[model samples]
Target: LHISSSWVRDSRFWKLVDQPAPKLESFSFVMERECDVEDNLTVLPRIFQDDMPKLRNLALVNVSSWPHNRFANLTRFSLEHQPPHIRPTFPEFLAFLAASPKLQELVL
Candidate 1:
Protein backbone atom coordinates (compact mmCIF):
# COMPACT_ATOMS: atom_id res chain seq x y z
CA LEU A 1 0.00 0.00 0.00
CA HIS A 2 1.48 3.34 -1.04
CA ILE A 3 0.53 5.83 1.65
CA SER A 4 1.04 9.13 -0.17
CA SER A 5 -1.20 11.26 2.05
CA SER A 6 -1.41 12.01 5.74
CA TRP A 7 -4.52 11.54 7.94
CA VAL A 8 -4.31 15.05 9.29
CA ARG A 9 -7.64 16.09 7.82
CA ASP A 10 -9.47 12.73 7.93
CA SER A 11 -8.72 9.03 7.86
CA ARG A 12 -10.23 8.08 4.56
CA PHE A 13 -7.45 5.64 3.83
CA TRP A 14 -8.11 3.72 6.98
CA LYS A 15 -11.18 2.28 5.31
CA LEU A 16 -9.08 0.56 2.66
CA VAL A 17 -6.91 -0.92 5.35
CA ASP A 18 -9.89 -2.25 7.28
CA GLN A 19 -10.81 -4.92 4.78
CA PRO A 20 -10.35 -8.49 6.00
CA ALA A 21 -7.63 -9.81 3.71
CA PRO A 22 -6.52 -13.26 4.76
CA LYS A 23 -4.24 -14.14 1.83
CA LEU A 24 -1.97 -11.13 2.03
CA GLU A 25 1.48 -12.17 3.10
CA SER A 26 3.75 -9.31 2.05
CA PHE A 27 3.38 -5.54 2.08
CA SER A 28 5.07 -2.52 0.53
CA PHE A 29 4.18 0.76 2.20
CA VAL A 30 5.43 4.13 0.99
CA MET A 31 4.78 7.31 2.90
CA GLU A 32 6.14 10.63 1.63
CA ARG A 33 5.71 12.81 4.72
CA GLU A 34 6.54 12.35 8.36
CA CYS A 35 3.83 12.85 10.93
CA ASP A 36 4.78 11.78 14.46
CA VAL A 37 1.35 11.66 15.99
CA GLU A 38 0.67 8.61 18.12
CA ASP A 39 -2.34 7.38 16.13
CA ASN A 40 -0.45 8.06 12.92
CA LEU A 41 1.36 4.76 13.09
CA THR A 42 -0.66 3.05 15.79
CA VAL A 43 -3.04 1.84 13.12
CA LEU A 44 -0.29 -0.31 11.62
CA PRO A 45 0.01 -3.03 14.23
CA ARG A 46 -3.67 -3.81 13.87
CA ILE A 47 -3.92 -3.30 10.11
CA PHE A 48 -1.22 -5.86 9.35
CA GLN A 49 -0.95 -8.15 12.35
CA ASP A 50 -3.52 -10.64 11.04
CA ASP A 51 -2.63 -10.95 7.35
CA MET A 52 1.16 -10.73 7.65
CA PRO A 53 1.82 -13.90 9.58
CA LYS A 54 3.72 -15.27 6.56
CA LEU A 55 4.87 -12.01 5.09
CA ARG A 56 8.46 -12.03 3.91
CA ASN A 57 9.14 -8.73 2.18
CA LEU A 58 8.44 -5.13 3.14
CA ALA A 59 9.42 -1.73 1.75
CA LEU A 60 9.14 1.78 3.13
CA VAL A 61 10.40 5.01 1.58
CA ASN A 62 10.28 8.63 2.72
CA VAL A 63 8.39 7.50 5.81
CA SER A 64 8.78 7.11 9.54
CA SER A 65 8.26 4.06 11.69
CA TRP A 66 7.64 5.52 15.09
CA PRO A 67 6.89 2.33 17.02
CA HIS A 68 8.23 0.16 14.18
CA ASN A 69 6.72 -2.96 15.70
CA ARG A 70 4.08 -3.44 13.01
CA PHE A 71 6.44 -5.32 10.70
CA ALA A 72 6.70 -8.52 12.69
CA ASN A 73 7.37 -10.96 9.87
CA LEU A 74 9.35 -9.22 7.15
CA THR A 75 12.28 -11.18 5.76
CA ARG A 76 13.39 -8.69 3.09
CA PHE A 77 13.10 -4.92 3.21
CA SER A 78 14.04 -1.80 1.22
CA LEU A 79 13.92 1.77 2.40
CA GLU A 80 14.89 5.20 0.99
CA HIS A 81 14.47 8.16 3.28
CA GLN A 82 14.61 11.85 2.60
CA PRO A 83 18.37 11.98 3.16
CA PRO A 84 18.28 8.26 2.31
CA HIS A 85 20.59 7.14 5.14
CA ILE A 86 19.38 8.62 8.38
CA ARG A 87 15.99 6.85 8.49
CA PRO A 88 17.64 3.55 9.17
CA THR A 89 20.15 5.09 11.53
CA PHE A 90 17.71 7.12 13.59
CA PRO A 91 16.92 3.85 15.33
CA GLU A 92 19.27 1.23 13.97
CA PHE A 93 17.18 0.03 11.02
CA LEU A 94 19.35 -3.05 10.89
CA ALA A 95 18.56 -3.88 14.48
CA PHE A 96 14.88 -3.38 13.81
CA LEU A 97 15.11 -6.62 11.87
CA ALA A 98 14.33 -8.31 15.15
CA ALA A 99 10.72 -7.83 14.11
CA SER A 100 11.57 -9.87 11.03
CA PRO A 101 13.63 -12.52 12.73
CA LYS A 102 13.96 -14.41 9.47
CA LEU A 103 15.15 -11.45 7.45
CA GLN A 104 18.16 -12.09 5.18
CA GLU A 105 18.22 -9.12 2.83
CA LEU A 106 18.55 -5.44 3.67
CA VAL A 107 18.51 -2.99 0.75
CA LEU A 108 19.03 0.65 1.52
Candidate 2:
Protein backbone atom coordinates (compact mmCIF):
# COMPACT_ATOMS: atom_id res chain seq x y z
CA LEU A 1 0.00 0.00 0.00
CA HIS A 2 1.30 3.42 -0.99
CA ILE A 3 -0.28 6.51 0.54
CA SER A 4 1.11 9.88 -0.51
CA SER A 5 -0.83 12.89 0.68
CA SER A 6 -0.84 15.67 3.19
CA TRP A 7 -3.91 13.99 4.67
CA VAL A 8 -1.69 11.26 6.03
CA ARG A 9 -0.85 13.62 8.88
CA ASP A 10 -4.28 12.80 10.22
CA SER A 11 -4.33 9.95 12.69
CA ARG A 12 -7.56 8.66 11.18
CA PHE A 13 -5.60 7.79 8.07
CA TRP A 14 -3.32 5.72 10.25
CA LYS A 15 -6.30 3.72 11.47
CA LEU A 16 -6.84 2.60 7.91
CA VAL A 17 -3.24 1.53 7.72
CA ASP A 18 -3.58 -0.36 11.00
CA GLN A 19 -6.45 -2.49 9.82
CA PRO A 20 -5.65 -6.12 9.34
CA ALA A 21 -4.70 -6.89 5.76
CA PRO A 22 -3.18 -10.33 5.36
CA LYS A 23 -1.53 -9.62 2.03
CA LEU A 24 0.02 -6.32 3.10
CA GLU A 25 3.75 -6.53 2.60
CA SER A 26 5.09 -3.17 1.58
CA PHE A 27 3.72 0.08 2.96
CA SER A 28 4.81 3.58 2.08
CA PHE A 29 3.16 6.55 3.75
CA VAL A 30 4.05 9.99 2.48
CA MET A 31 2.93 13.29 3.90
CA GLU A 32 3.54 16.15 1.50
CA ARG A 33 3.22 18.67 4.32
CA GLU A 34 4.78 18.68 7.73
CA CYS A 35 2.48 18.21 10.67
CA ASP A 36 1.77 20.99 13.11
CA VAL A 37 -0.15 21.39 16.37
CA GLU A 38 -3.30 22.11 14.41
CA ASP A 39 -3.11 18.65 12.95
CA ASN A 40 -3.45 17.13 16.45
CA LEU A 41 -1.03 14.45 15.44
CA THR A 42 0.46 12.02 17.89
CA VAL A 43 3.34 9.62 17.73
CA LEU A 44 2.38 6.88 15.30
CA PRO A 45 3.38 3.31 15.76
CA ARG A 46 5.08 1.45 12.95
CA ILE A 47 1.48 0.47 11.99
CA PHE A 48 1.87 -3.30 11.91
CA GLN A 49 2.12 -4.47 15.46
CA ASP A 50 1.23 -8.14 15.58
CA ASP A 51 -0.24 -8.50 12.12
CA MET A 52 1.37 -8.21 8.68
CA PRO A 53 3.78 -11.09 9.01
CA LYS A 54 4.93 -10.78 5.44
CA LEU A 55 5.72 -7.09 5.68
CA ARG A 56 9.23 -6.39 4.49
CA ASN A 57 9.53 -2.81 3.31
CA LEU A 58 8.29 0.31 5.06
CA ALA A 59 8.73 3.99 4.34
CA LEU A 60 7.51 7.17 5.97
CA VAL A 61 7.83 10.66 4.54
CA ASN A 62 7.56 13.87 6.50
CA VAL A 63 6.36 12.11 9.60
CA SER A 64 6.68 12.95 13.25
CA SER A 65 7.63 10.27 15.74
CA TRP A 66 7.63 6.53 15.09
CA PRO A 67 7.08 4.26 18.03
CA HIS A 68 9.75 1.76 18.94
CA ASN A 69 8.47 -1.64 17.90
CA ARG A 70 9.85 -4.73 16.31
CA PHE A 71 9.04 -5.75 12.77
CA ALA A 72 10.87 -9.05 12.73
CA ASN A 73 10.46 -9.68 9.02
CA LEU A 74 11.11 -6.18 7.85
CA THR A 75 14.05 -5.75 5.50
CA ARG A 76 13.94 -2.22 4.18
CA PHE A 77 12.93 0.93 5.98
CA SER A 78 13.10 4.58 5.02
CA LEU A 79 12.31 7.93 6.59
CA GLU A 80 12.53 11.27 4.84
CA HIS A 81 12.18 14.97 5.51
CA GLN A 82 11.27 14.91 9.19
CA PRO A 83 11.75 18.29 10.77
CA PRO A 84 14.22 18.50 13.66
CA HIS A 85 11.55 19.58 16.10
CA ILE A 86 9.41 16.51 15.40
CA ARG A 87 12.07 14.03 14.48
CA PRO A 88 12.85 11.05 16.70
CA THR A 89 15.77 11.46 19.03
CA PHE A 90 18.91 9.40 18.47
CA PRO A 91 18.01 6.99 21.27
CA GLU A 92 14.53 6.49 19.87
CA PHE A 93 15.88 5.93 16.40
CA LEU A 94 18.40 3.47 17.77
CA ALA A 95 15.66 1.57 19.56
CA PHE A 96 13.74 1.30 16.31
CA LEU A 97 16.83 -0.08 14.61
CA ALA A 98 17.38 -2.56 17.40
CA ALA A 99 13.86 -3.85 16.98
CA SER A 100 14.16 -4.71 13.30
CA PRO A 101 16.63 -7.54 13.40
CA LYS A 102 16.27 -8.35 9.72
CA LEU A 103 16.60 -4.78 8.52
CA GLN A 104 19.10 -4.60 5.68
CA GLU A 105 18.60 -1.33 3.87
CA LEU A 106 17.84 1.91 5.68
CA VAL A 107 17.42 5.42 4.30
CA LEU A 108 17.18 8.39 6.65
Candidate 3:
Protein backbone atom coordinates (compact mmCIF):
# COMPACT_ATOMS: atom_id res chain seq x y z
CA LEU A 1 0.00 0.00 0.00
CA HIS A 2 1.21 3.48 -0.94
CA ILE A 3 -0.44 6.79 -0.19
CA SER A 4 0.66 10.33 -0.96
CA SER A 5 -1.45 13.31 -0.23
CA SER A 6 -1.09 17.06 0.29
CA TRP A 7 -2.66 19.28 2.93
CA VAL A 8 -4.11 16.42 4.92
CA ARG A 9 -4.82 16.37 8.61
CA ASP A 10 -2.78 14.06 10.80
CA SER A 11 -5.90 12.29 12.04
CA ARG A 12 -7.46 11.82 8.64
CA PHE A 13 -4.28 10.37 7.17
CA TRP A 14 -4.02 7.68 9.81
CA LYS A 15 -7.45 6.09 9.88
CA LEU A 16 -6.17 2.62 9.14
CA VAL A 17 -7.71 -0.77 9.74
CA ASP A 18 -7.31 -2.26 13.18
CA GLN A 19 -6.00 -5.59 11.93
CA PRO A 20 -2.81 -7.31 10.91
CA ALA A 21 -1.39 -6.92 7.43
CA PRO A 22 -0.57 -10.57 7.03
CA LYS A 23 0.38 -10.46 3.38
CA LEU A 24 1.56 -6.90 3.11
CA GLU A 25 5.12 -6.68 1.84
CA SER A 26 5.46 -2.95 1.32
CA PHE A 27 3.79 0.08 2.84
CA SER A 28 4.45 3.77 2.33
CA PHE A 29 2.60 6.86 3.47
CA VAL A 30 3.51 10.45 2.65
CA MET A 31 1.43 13.31 3.94
CA GLU A 32 2.06 17.01 3.40
CA ARG A 33 0.34 19.52 5.60
CA GLU A 34 -0.42 23.11 4.74
CA CYS A 35 2.35 25.50 5.70
CA ASP A 36 0.10 27.75 7.72
CA VAL A 37 -1.19 24.98 9.96
CA GLU A 38 0.43 24.29 13.27
CA ASP A 39 1.51 20.77 14.05
CA ASN A 40 -0.92 18.72 16.09
CA LEU A 41 1.14 15.66 16.77
CA THR A 42 -0.55 12.34 17.44
CA VAL A 43 0.82 8.94 18.20
CA LEU A 44 0.08 6.14 15.80
CA PRO A 45 -2.23 3.64 17.42
CA ARG A 46 -1.18 0.07 18.05
CA ILE A 47 -3.45 -1.43 15.50
CA PHE A 48 -1.35 -4.19 13.95
CA GLN A 49 0.10 -5.24 17.29
CA ASP A 50 3.43 -6.08 15.64
CA ASP A 51 2.00 -9.06 13.81
CA MET A 52 3.17 -8.25 10.32
CA PRO A 53 5.28 -11.30 9.68
CA LYS A 54 5.73 -10.85 5.97
CA LEU A 55 6.31 -7.13 5.82
CA ARG A 56 9.62 -6.21 4.22
CA ASN A 57 9.49 -2.52 3.41
CA LEU A 58 8.10 0.48 5.26
CA ALA A 59 8.34 4.20 4.63
CA LEU A 60 6.75 7.30 6.06
CA VAL A 61 7.15 10.99 5.31
CA ASN A 62 6.04 14.00 7.32
CA VAL A 63 4.62 11.73 9.98
CA SER A 64 4.30 13.02 13.50
CA SER A 65 4.37 9.75 15.42
CA TRP A 66 5.82 6.32 15.24
CA PRO A 67 3.93 3.07 15.39
CA HIS A 68 4.26 0.81 18.40
CA ASN A 69 5.04 -2.32 16.43
CA ARG A 70 8.24 -4.35 16.31
CA PHE A 71 8.97 -5.18 12.73
CA ALA A 72 11.09 -8.32 12.64
CA ASN A 73 11.21 -8.92 8.91
CA LEU A 74 11.66 -5.47 7.50
CA THR A 75 14.42 -5.19 4.93
CA ARG A 76 13.99 -1.51 4.27
CA PHE A 77 12.73 1.28 6.47
CA SER A 78 12.59 4.98 5.77
CA LEU A 79 11.37 8.02 7.66
CA GLU A 80 11.59 11.54 6.31
CA HIS A 81 10.48 15.08 7.09
CA GLN A 82 9.48 14.35 10.67
CA PRO A 83 9.36 17.22 13.09
CA PRO A 84 12.20 17.41 15.62
CA HIS A 85 9.86 17.02 18.58
CA ILE A 86 8.37 13.85 17.19
CA ARG A 87 11.68 12.22 16.30
CA PRO A 88 12.39 8.95 18.05
CA THR A 89 14.69 8.87 21.02
CA PHE A 90 18.09 7.22 20.57
CA PRO A 91 17.17 4.14 22.56
CA GLU A 92 13.83 3.82 20.87
CA PHE A 93 15.44 3.98 17.46
CA LEU A 94 18.09 1.49 18.57
CA ALA A 95 15.40 -0.87 19.78
CA PHE A 96 13.65 -0.68 16.45
CA LEU A 97 16.92 -1.45 14.66
CA ALA A 98 17.64 -4.28 17.06
CA ALA A 99 14.24 -5.82 16.43
CA SER A 100 14.73 -5.92 12.69
CA PRO A 101 17.75 -8.16 12.23
CA LYS A 102 17.03 -8.52 8.56
CA LEU A 103 16.99 -4.81 7.88
CA GLN A 104 19.31 -3.93 5.01
CA GLU A 105 18.35 -0.35 4.16
CA LEU A 106 17.48 2.52 6.43
CA VAL A 107 16.83 6.16 5.58
CA LEU A 108 16.04 9.02 7.93
Candidate 4:
Protein backbone atom coordinates (compact mmCIF):
# COMPACT_ATOMS: atom_id res chain seq x y z
CA LEU A 1 0.00 0.00 0.00
CA HIS A 2 1.77 3.12 -1.24
CA ILE A 3 0.59 6.48 0.08
CA SER A 4 1.57 9.51 -1.98
CA SER A 5 0.36 13.03 -1.67
CA SER A 6 1.37 16.66 -1.82
CA TRP A 7 1.86 18.60 1.38
CA VAL A 8 0.10 16.24 3.76
CA ARG A 9 -0.69 18.02 6.97
CA ASP A 10 1.45 16.80 9.87
CA SER A 11 -1.53 16.11 12.10
CA ARG A 12 -3.25 13.97 9.49
CA PHE A 13 -0.14 11.92 8.94
CA TRP A 14 0.45 11.29 12.61
CA LYS A 15 -3.18 10.41 13.12
CA LEU A 16 -2.87 7.60 10.61
CA VAL A 17 0.32 6.44 12.27
CA ASP A 18 -1.25 6.48 15.70
CA GLN A 19 -3.68 3.75 14.64
CA PRO A 20 -2.69 0.17 15.36
CA ALA A 21 -1.60 -2.08 12.51
CA PRO A 22 -1.36 -5.41 14.18
CA LYS A 23 -0.74 -7.68 11.19
CA LEU A 24 1.49 -5.45 9.16
CA GLU A 25 4.34 -7.38 7.57
CA SER A 26 6.03 -4.75 5.44
CA PHE A 27 6.08 -0.97 5.70
CA SER A 28 7.78 1.71 3.64
CA PHE A 29 7.30 5.40 4.26
CA VAL A 30 8.44 8.21 2.00
CA MET A 31 8.06 11.88 2.71
CA GLU A 32 8.41 13.83 -0.52
CA ARG A 33 9.68 17.35 -0.22
CA GLU A 34 11.91 19.79 -2.01
CA CYS A 35 15.61 19.23 -1.47
CA ASP A 36 16.19 22.80 -0.34
CA VAL A 37 13.77 22.62 2.58
CA GLU A 38 14.89 20.94 5.74
CA ASP A 39 13.36 17.52 6.50
CA ASN A 40 12.78 17.53 10.23
CA LEU A 41 10.34 14.64 10.42
CA THR A 42 11.01 12.11 13.12
CA VAL A 43 9.72 8.58 13.81
CA LEU A 44 9.24 8.20 17.51
CA PRO A 45 10.59 5.07 19.22
CA ARG A 46 7.20 3.94 20.48
CA ILE A 47 5.70 3.85 17.00
CA PHE A 48 7.08 0.35 16.62
CA GLN A 49 7.53 -0.56 20.23
CA ASP A 50 4.66 -3.03 19.83
CA ASP A 51 2.15 -4.45 17.32
CA MET A 52 4.80 -4.92 14.63
CA PRO A 53 6.36 -8.20 15.56
CA LYS A 54 5.62 -9.66 12.14
CA LEU A 55 7.15 -6.85 10.11
CA ARG A 56 9.74 -8.23 7.68
CA ASN A 57 10.46 -5.53 5.13
CA LEU A 58 10.95 -1.96 6.33
CA ALA A 59 12.19 1.02 4.39
CA LEU A 60 12.19 4.72 5.12
CA VAL A 61 13.09 7.46 2.66
CA ASN A 62 13.70 11.12 3.27
CA VAL A 63 13.26 10.59 6.96
CA SER A 64 15.19 12.72 9.43
CA SER A 65 15.18 10.69 12.62
CA TRP A 66 14.22 7.01 13.06
CA PRO A 67 14.14 6.01 16.70
CA HIS A 68 12.15 2.79 16.56
CA ASN A 69 13.01 -0.72 17.72
CA ARG A 70 10.71 -2.97 15.72
CA PHE A 71 13.24 -4.81 13.58
CA ALA A 72 13.76 -7.88 15.67
CA ASN A 73 12.06 -10.05 13.04
CA LEU A 74 12.76 -8.06 9.91
CA THR A 75 14.47 -9.66 6.94
CA ARG A 76 15.04 -6.61 4.77
CA PHE A 77 15.71 -3.03 5.87
CA SER A 78 16.56 0.14 4.02
CA LEU A 79 17.16 3.75 4.97
CA GLU A 80 17.71 6.26 2.24
CA HIS A 81 17.69 9.95 1.42
CA GLN A 82 18.07 11.04 5.01
CA PRO A 83 19.21 14.49 6.02
CA PRO A 84 22.86 14.67 7.07
CA HIS A 85 22.28 16.18 10.49
CA ILE A 86 19.62 13.70 11.64
CA ARG A 87 21.17 10.54 10.24
CA PRO A 88 22.27 8.00 12.76
CA THR A 89 25.96 7.46 13.42
CA PHE A 90 27.68 4.33 12.11
CA PRO A 91 27.85 2.80 15.55
CA GLU A 92 24.21 3.49 16.22
CA PHE A 93 23.24 1.98 12.89
CA LEU A 94 25.28 -1.09 13.66
CA ALA A 95 23.63 -1.44 17.02
CA PHE A 96 20.22 -1.19 15.44
CA LEU A 97 21.12 -4.00 13.07
CA ALA A 98 22.58 -6.07 15.85
CA ALA A 99 19.15 -6.20 17.42
CA SER A 100 17.73 -7.71 14.23
CA PRO A 101 19.16 -11.19 14.31
CA LYS A 102 16.99 -12.31 11.41
CA LEU A 103 17.92 -9.49 9.08
CA GLN A 104 19.19 -10.78 5.74
CA GLU A 105 19.47 -7.66 3.60
CA LEU A 106 20.35 -4.12 4.63
CA VAL A 107 20.71 -0.88 2.72
CA LEU A 108 21.87 2.30 4.40
lDDT of 1 by residue, 83-103 (tens): 532344744755676556777
* TM-score, every prediction: 0.56, 0.76, 0.79, 0.78
Which sequence of candidate numbers ranks them by TM-score, best first? Answer: 3, 4, 2, 1
The sequence of per-residue lDDT tens digits that candidate 3 reaches over residues 37-104 is: 33533345554556678989998777676677888899999987777666889998899899999999
Q: lDDT per prediction?
A: 0.55, 0.73, 0.73, 0.70
Q: Deviation in angstroms for 6 in model 4? A: 4.1
- Write the residue-wise lDDT of candidate 4 on 42-93 in tens digits: 4444454366778888877666767466578889988887767777789988
The candidate with the higher TM-score, 1 or 3, is: 3
Which candidate would rank higher by lDDT, 2 or 3?
3
lDDT of 1 at 89: 74
TM-score of candidate 3 to 2 decimals:
0.79
Report how far off residue 2 is in candidate 3 (Å).
0.8
Residue 98 of model 4 has an lDDT of: 89
Highest lDDT model number = 3
Clashing pairs in 3: none
Judged by lDDT against the true structure, how good is candidate 4? 0.70
- lDDT assessment of candidate 3: 0.73
Clashes of each: 0, 0, 0, 0
Q: List ranges where model 1 is wrong by over 4 Å.
A: 1-10, 18-21, 32-46, 49-51, 70-72, 82-95
Query: Model 3, which residues run further than 4 Å from truth?
Result: 6-15, 34-42
